[model samples]
Structure formats: C-alpha cells, structure tokens
Target chain A: MTAPHEPIPGTTIFDGRMAMKGYPLNKMCYSFNEAAARQEFLADEDAYCAKFGLTDEQKTAIKERNALALLAAGGNIYYLAKFIGMLGLNVQDIGAQQTGMTVEEFKAKLKAAGN
Target chain B: MAKIVGGVTTSHIPAIGNAIANELFEDPYWKPFFDGYPKAREWLAEVKPDVAIVVYNDHGLNFFLDKMPTFSIGAAPEYQNKDEGWGLKPLPPYPGDPELSWHIIESLVNDEFDICSCQEMAVDHGFTVPMALLWPDQTQRPVRTIPVAVNTVQHPLPTPARCLKLGEAIGRAVASYPKDLKVVVLGTGGLSHQLDGERAGFINKDFDLMCLEKIVDEPEALAKYSIHDLVRLAGAQGAELILWLIMRGALGRKVSKVHSNYHIPISNTGAGLLVLESAA
Candidate 1:
C-alpha cells in the first residue's frame, strides 16, 4: 500500500493511490463504455466482477449500486458514471445518492441555488 | 509558417447539448445560459479558421482507466461521437486535421511533452457539446478539429503549471508548421460546479469570474493553484478549468479578450465562454 495522505472532507479525490487501489473496479466500469460489456455485466454482475477481479468491498459496492460506496471502494466518478449510466442514472442521480438525498430533492436544491 | 490565431473557452456541459437539441434555449430556465452563446457563434463565423484545436476531457467515452493517457492527441482522419450510454443522438463525424495533428504530436514530443497519439477516438459530449454550441449547424462547422484530451477525471491530474507548459509547447508546435494555416485553440470544461459528495452543488462565481479575468492576461499565475485548492475553490468537476490554461498558454504572452459571457446554475455549473485573440 502507498503512504497515506490527508483526505479532503466531503470529497473523494481519486489520486494515484486510489487509482491503483481501484484498478479492477475502474477497469470493470471502463468496460461498460461498450454496450456489450454493459449488457454482460447486467446479465451476471458477480461473474463480471470476478472477471475484472474486483475485491470483496468493490463487489459489495457494485451489488449495492451506490456511487459513494463505489468511490469509497476506490472507483473514480468518471468510471463510476459508466456503472450508474448502465442503471439509467446520471451524475445528478449519483450526486443525490452521495449527498443522501432523493433525486427530486437534489434537483430542487440545484434549482434554488441558481445564480 | 502557420500562426496561432486565437483561443476559445467554454463549459462543455452535456445538459447544454440537451437544451440545444430539444430547443429549450428560449425557456426561462435555460434562456440565461443560452443567451451567452450567440455572440460566440457570431464571433466564430467572423473569425473562421482552417482548423480548431479542441482541448477537452473524455468522460469514459474513450480511453478508460485501463490505460488513461495524461495527455492524448487525436491524429485520426475523423472522429465519431459516441452514445455514452445516455441515448443522446450522436452528432455527425467531425473532420480531423491529421497533418496538423501530426505536426503537433511531433512538436510536443520533441518538446518532451510525451503525449499519447491516438489514430482513432470516439468523442463524447466533452468534445461534441461545445462544437454544437459554437457551430449549431453540423453542415457548416466553422473549422475542422484536432482534439487534445487531458485526464481531469483521475486524480493526480496534470497541474495547472503543467497544463500551461503543455499549451505553450502546443503554441510553439502550431507556429512551427510550415503551412500557412490559421488555427484556433479551444479549451473546454468547467467554470465551477462540483458533481459529487455532500458538496455536490458547489459553485463559486467569484472564482469563475477570477479565472475569466486572469486567463486573459495572467494565465501563468493560475499554475500556482494546487489541484486540492482547485477542488476546494472551483469544485470537483470545476477542476477541469486547468484545461483552459492549455488554451491560454497556446495564445502567447499577450491576448485580447474579444468576447466573453458567464451565467450561473446551468445544471449545477457556472457556465462561461470567451474568445481571446493573439495580441501579436
């Protein structure tokens, strides 16, 4: 493992260390860039995770389909977007999940925060 | 010899593309955001260049985590837009300038930039949305494009200084070409707005405005901003502003800001646009 660095509060910075740690998870997510990979994963997620060699924690995060959990498990948001996109979720939906709010609530917050 | 004519910068938000596709420009919710582009489109029409160097980051449409290149230049004859799993209608294939792309690759490599040269790339909204905004009509694209893809998604991102230096190298490369070509460099993505975490809705108009001001004259100063500090000040996704420095760097030491516009909360972003011409 690499030396531990200070963590930014309210943000999971996907630094080199996280990139290394989440390689399998990110690689799996990256594969979803192709439609066949997205379908294969949806058809059998466990097998897909195994094929990419995801860790137990990463596997659990995938099963839960939680963006924050996936981030905690070392998934970068860009790569994770592919995973969420497979579920018909957008970045806003992931933001809603990360902030522990419903999608509607998050959209309301965004609308209210207009400049 | 070729000359770097100028640069354009804008936020390549996907929602902006959706608005344009659905004809929501006149809607009150999107009007302010769309209001900022007419001048840009008009300016593009007036200053038509032979080629445009588009600087943007891919959102997993091409080059995934498997082998993420810190900097990738598309040298293909043309680039096709990918669906990105969102069912958005793909734009027509963009014509690429391989000759210019090759010249840039050779120049950047000689300058020790160590860029990844891609013969084929499927562009996502990062490359497409801004083009859509600027050109609006696919049949009449203002200029052919050469895409410069930087890695802003993975952390340990290229520093502002590095991006600036790369841009300078690119400027040199473009200028060194023997052909008498007019080229415009475009830096896309970010003007503040985070996309995740509890701080998901983060937006700093002051910082975004500061960038618009500083990028015109003092882009080198922006290099001092650390990635962590950028995330704090500009938000996660907003950190992509570093890409703008690439465009600024290519414009030489002095530039004239010909046009600019800024509006807030375009789907959780402080959308900004600018056209800078080389002072020389």
Candidate 2:
C-alpha cells in the first residue's frame, strides 16, 4: 500500500508469475481444457482443417513437430503416437502401451525415464 | 491543449480479436455475442476520439512470469506486435505520440504520480483487443495513445481504492498537461468473468450492472469493494474491473454515461463496454 503513483518503490513490471495471477486461465494447468480446444481435437480431418484453415502441409508439420518433441524426450513410441493422433496429427501407433497418462506427468515421466 | 474527451471501459478477451478480424464471429458460437453491441459500433464511429490512454493488464506477455511491474507506461514512438509462443498476429505496429507521452510523464510526475516509462516494449492482446474493437477501421488511430499496464495478474494486487486514486492522479496528469489534444482514457477488462477450473463460465449480470452503475454515478462507492469481493462474486478474472475504476477516477466526480453495452456470449465471462463523458 504505497502512496498513490509511488509505484511501490522498486516495482519491476516484467514478472510473469504476478501477471499470470491476474488472469491465470491463459496459462493455468499444463494443457487447454476449453471445449473449443477439445472440439477441435476431436473433429474429423476435413472439418478440423476447414475450421482452423490449416493446409495439409501445416497439419503434417505439426504432427512431425510433436513427434520429434516426443522422441527427443524418449516418450513411449505408442503413447506418443496416440497423443499425436488425439491431436488429429498424422502419426500412427507404433505398438506402445496405452497406459493412462496425464500429459504433464507423461512428459515428466518420459524425461525421467530416458535420462 | 489536451482536453478530456471522456472514458471507455471494455473487456479485452483475446478471442474477440480473432473472432472479429478473421470474421469468425459468424461462427454460431461467437456471432450472436458481438451482435448485441450495435451501439458500440455506432459510438466508435461517432465519438471518434483523437487520442486514448489505454489502461490494461498485461498477461506475462511483455513482462515474463518471473518479474512483474505494478504499473508501466509506454512512451515509445511505436510498439511492435509480440510473439506469445503462438506466433505473432500480423497487425500493423501501433504508432505512439512520444511528445504527448513525455508530456504526460512529466505532468504525472509533477502531480506526484510516479510513472515507469518504456521506450521499447511489445504490447500483447490486452492492449490490441480494445484497440481493434473501438478502431476496427484503423482510420485515423485518431487517438494517439498512452499505454498504461497494470499488474492485475499477481497477488497483493492493487486494491480497488488504490486503482481509483491512481485514476484520479492520471486525470490530473492529463488535465494539467500543456498540450492541446482531445484525450480519452480507455480502461480495458471485465464486467464479471471467471476463466479458471470449476468456476469457469461464471457470469454475474447483477454484479456487472452494479459495477456499471457505480463506475459512472458513484465510483467512490466502488472503492469499498475489494479484489476478494470481486473474486468471490464475479470470479478472479472479474477483479480486472479494478482497472475500470481507475478510468472512472481519472474522469472524476460525475460522469455522464454516453453508451454502455453488456453481453455474455462466452463462458463464465460477461463482455461489457461503456463510454463516459466528463461532467465538465
């Protein structure tokens, strides 16, 4: 409670932690839970593509990118592929276990297990 | 010759910009919501303010999640669009009026309002959404702007009363400036919205209307309400409305509501807009 316009003395504005407290939803949790995000993930290829206006190349690129990220972290080939598929990516299953996974925990486990 | 043109309060939901610019409003989900604000569209064209001091809260875009400034003012000649991990939205860079900005900084300081001035910083959707809403045509950008960022995202967030006092200081700063330009201060964010777990989609129309009432007719009354009260009733995100009180305070004692629109087209969030002309 500093004086009006005193700027709290040494206040610095770049702290993201404080900024997120203002509207944490934009960054809350590791993944998006909004219906729109879920709907897009569940939509059929053509419908999804039409909605986001993404080209086939762009979609393919997203899949490759996610797959590369998974591989780099040594994720289970099968679950990683499933996760990609869930996002409507082009990757197919590589015979990995379908063990229930929380996306954040899964990433952490993948990293810990590999490293 | 800086004249107080009035004040504007609006919700700055990031999705609104994409919905409007990409014409996604036609999507059944978003279209009906914006259609509710025909008067806002008309007012934007009618008032056509010459300059706007936009008050908004940055969501860790320009400032990282690590360090937060309670308030920062942009005094740069131009502000570039930022890339918030999702890639940059290809909008033209905003042209700033540095001379007027410096004048504001000096006047505010003289009036005992310590302001942090920035020459180069990327502004996020919090700044752009309202800009796009009121100036969709990008016509004159008629309002050369003084961008004011508030730290609404963090705890120990500034109290509603504190924000109002700051607004009064801002009004003094603008009123005392020696230039000659019509200035409108735009306060961005909230009517009543909660975008968090379990409480996501909370909308309190009653609280929203009360806010509209108090902001225009009795801003001092609103100062009694706390961030806790807003969070408990309207949800945490709704607390951002504290920024509006600052605009109201800047305008001072009595303000005539020129136009106001409140709509809830999105989950747990009420999108509202209002324009106020100073009593003088």
Best by TM-score: 1
**Candidate 2 stretches greater than 4 Å from native:** A1-115, B25-28, B36-38, B138-140
TM-score of chain B of each: 0.98, 0.92
Whole-model lDDT values for every prediction: 0.86, 0.63
| Candidate 1 wrongly placed segments (more than 4 Å) | A1-6, A111-115
State the lDDT of candidate 2 residue by residue for A18-112, as single tens digits: 23332322222112223344455456544553454444544553345433323222222222222343344321111111223344443343233
**lDDT (Cα, tens digit) per residue for candidate 2, span B107-203:** 7777776677889877777788888887776544556777888877656678898899889887877777677777888899887765432233446
- Supply candidate 2's per-residue lDDT for B120: 81
Q: Candidate 1, which CAPRI tier?
A: medium
Please report, as a residue range, the 10-residue window in candidate 1 chain B with the lowest summed lDDT: B82-91
Model 2 alpha-carbon miss at residue A32, Å? 14
Backbone clashes under 3 angstroms, per model? 0, 26
For candidate 2 chain B, the 10 contiguous residues with the lowest summed lDDT are: B193-202
